[model samples]
Target chain A: MKFTIQVNEGPYQHQATDSAYLFTKAALEKGHEIFRVFFYHDGVNNGTRLTTPPQDDRNIVKRWSELSAEHDLDLVICVAAAQRRGIVDDGEAERNGKDATNIAPGFRISGLGQLVEGAIQSDRLVVFGD
Target chain B: MSEIKKFMYVNRRAPYGTIYAWESLEVVLIGAAFEQDVSMAFIDDGVYQLTKGQDTTGLEMKNFSPTYSALGDYEVTKIYIEKESLEERGLTLEDLQHLTWEDEDEDWAEKDSIKLVSRAEMAQVFADQDVFFNF
Candidate 1:
């Protein structure tokens, strides 16, 4: 089965990303395919490339990056949410004349339509929230 | 159900803390206008949305749970609750007006139509749907 996972809350507030990770791992372990993982609302924070958590704690951003690289999962960050939260791609950073973009590797900034598309295309759609 | 689009609206916030619940309801209403089949699953603090007779006049927050009652008019009738959440909050079916709570004496695993379910089942609800929106 193919699955689409949506994360709505931001990092640190709830275990949104962590839950996403666990679900993704479980799906893969069960021999299920991950269609996409779309981050929206405060979840856009998960795509921030500059996040640096303490060494003692699990680094959710890095873990997501690793997962994407291993499974070739589509990690989509809502563009509007990203920009508003100061997470921009290089193109967006240049377009807006910002010196930097905070979008992390293994994640791409897109639109809500991608989420809509993911929902329409996937066999199953799961949400991780509080 | 004629190949209808299935939407799962996940409510995660408290009833009056923010506009999450109202905004989610508006989306559901819009989906219903388009003749979509909508289901709502409340988790965490969102369960408070089903608690009855809330007075928000002084808090200046809209009593949004009433809008949930209007869902039937919009053709949205399916509502689900997380079992562990209810247990965690010590809230019983008597605390919620619209909740379809099963009798404690029943032998059924999940007897209530407006039933309580496990976390994995909650996640499965999202997976089973075509469009799952969280608020």
Candidate 2:
């Protein structure tokens, strides 16, 4: 089965990001295809590279980056949502006249259409949020 | 080609207080272009989204309440409002805006777009969905 995961909350504010990550990993371990992981709302915070947790704590952003790299998964952050919350990639930062980009590794900023596309293409669209 | 699927957007939040309600509408508007089988469930505080006489002037917000009426123009006609949600909030179907859509298949007849469903009926609607989006 193919699954598309949507995480709608930020890393630490809610347990949604953690649950989504674990679910994605478990699905991959079960040999299922992860079509995409689309981040919207506060979930776009997960794509920022500037987060620094305690040395002993799990780094949610780093975990997602590593998982995406290992599985070659598509981690999409909604461009509209990202812009509202200042989660910019290099291209977006340059275009928006910002001085820096903070998008985490293995994540790309895209439109909301990607979420709809994920729904159409995947066997299941699991949403984790408030 | 991607296969069409039954997509249900579960809305449980009130508008303006948070960005979830407005952002969810954005997804639904974009999702409409995909031509999927789409439906929206308004439960909990989400039922407040359909209430009439909304004025955001004092709040300095954009007043997105009118957008709900425009949903029909985008072919997003199946809006389900939970019966219990309405009653719990001291509201009824009459407290909501009279939303309607023209059914071309029915000879361009204007039809009510919102459906009032019991909680039990909503459970069955959930069971029928291939995808569930909650925000």
Candidate 3:
């Protein structure tokens, strides 16, 4: 079965964004196809390339990048949400004339329509949040 | 046979805590606009949405609980709540102003479409949905 998971909260706040990392890993471990991972609201922060967690803690950004790289999953950050939170990729930053972009590779900035499209295309859209 | 596409919108925060509640409502509206059957589940702080008599007063935000009623107009009438959350917060059915009690329906109480259920059941519902989103 194909699954499209939406992560909309946590990590930045008191909740856990690790849900995004764990769910994606579990889906792949189970041999299920990950249709996409749509990050909306504060959840878009998960795609930022500039996140630096404590050395003892889990590196969520790196985990997401590795999962996307190895499994070839579509890791999408809602562009509107990302822009609102200042999480721009190099292309978006350049278009907006910013000095630098913070979004990581393997993750693309997309519109909320991509989230809607994920719903339309995937068999299951499991949401992970607080 | 093709499986019916089921969409579940997870409202995780309070109605006024942030823009999450409003954005979540929009996403659900979009899902219904696509002719998909959509359901909503309130968890953690999200239960505040169903609480009665919210006075935003000086918060300078919109009171969107009424929009919950409008969801039915969009063909999204199934709203679920977690039982443990209700008890943990000391909220009962009466604490919610908009919800109709299951027992109130003489014939449908046993099968009332909208009401509260246990967390385990909520987990099952999550597993059942084709499109599950959090706000």
Point to the candidate with the largest DockQ: 2
| Model 1 residue pairs with clashes | A49-A104
lDDT of 1 by residue, A1-130 (tens): 9888988788777887788889998899899988899887678888876888888988888888888988888999877667767888888888889998788789998766666666666787788875
Candidate 1 per-residue lDDT, tens place, B5-122, comes to 7878788778776656765665566556556567889899888888888888999866777776666566566788888788789997678766332334555333334667788888
Ranking by DockQ: 2, 3, 1
In model 3, the Cα lDDT at residue B7 comes to 72
The TM-score, computed over Cα atoms with residue i paired to residue i, of candidate 3 is: 0.67
2 or 3, which is superior by DockQ?
2
Q: Arrange candidates by TM-score, highest first: which order?
A: 2, 3, 1
Q: Is the docking of candidate 2 incorrect, acceptable, medium or high quality?
A: medium
Per lDDT, the best of the predicted structures is 2
Model 2 chain A worst lDDT run, 10 consecutive residues? A121-130
Off by over 4 Å in 3: A10-15, A54-57, A90-100, B1-4, B10-13, B18-20, B41-47, B50-57, B65-73, B77-135
Enumerate the candidates' DockQ scores in order. 0.13, 0.80, 0.23
Consecutive 10-residue window with the lowest summed lDDT within model 2 chain B: B1-10
Q: What is the lDDT of every predicted structure here?
A: 0.77, 0.93, 0.78
Model 3 scores a C-alpha lDDT of: 0.78
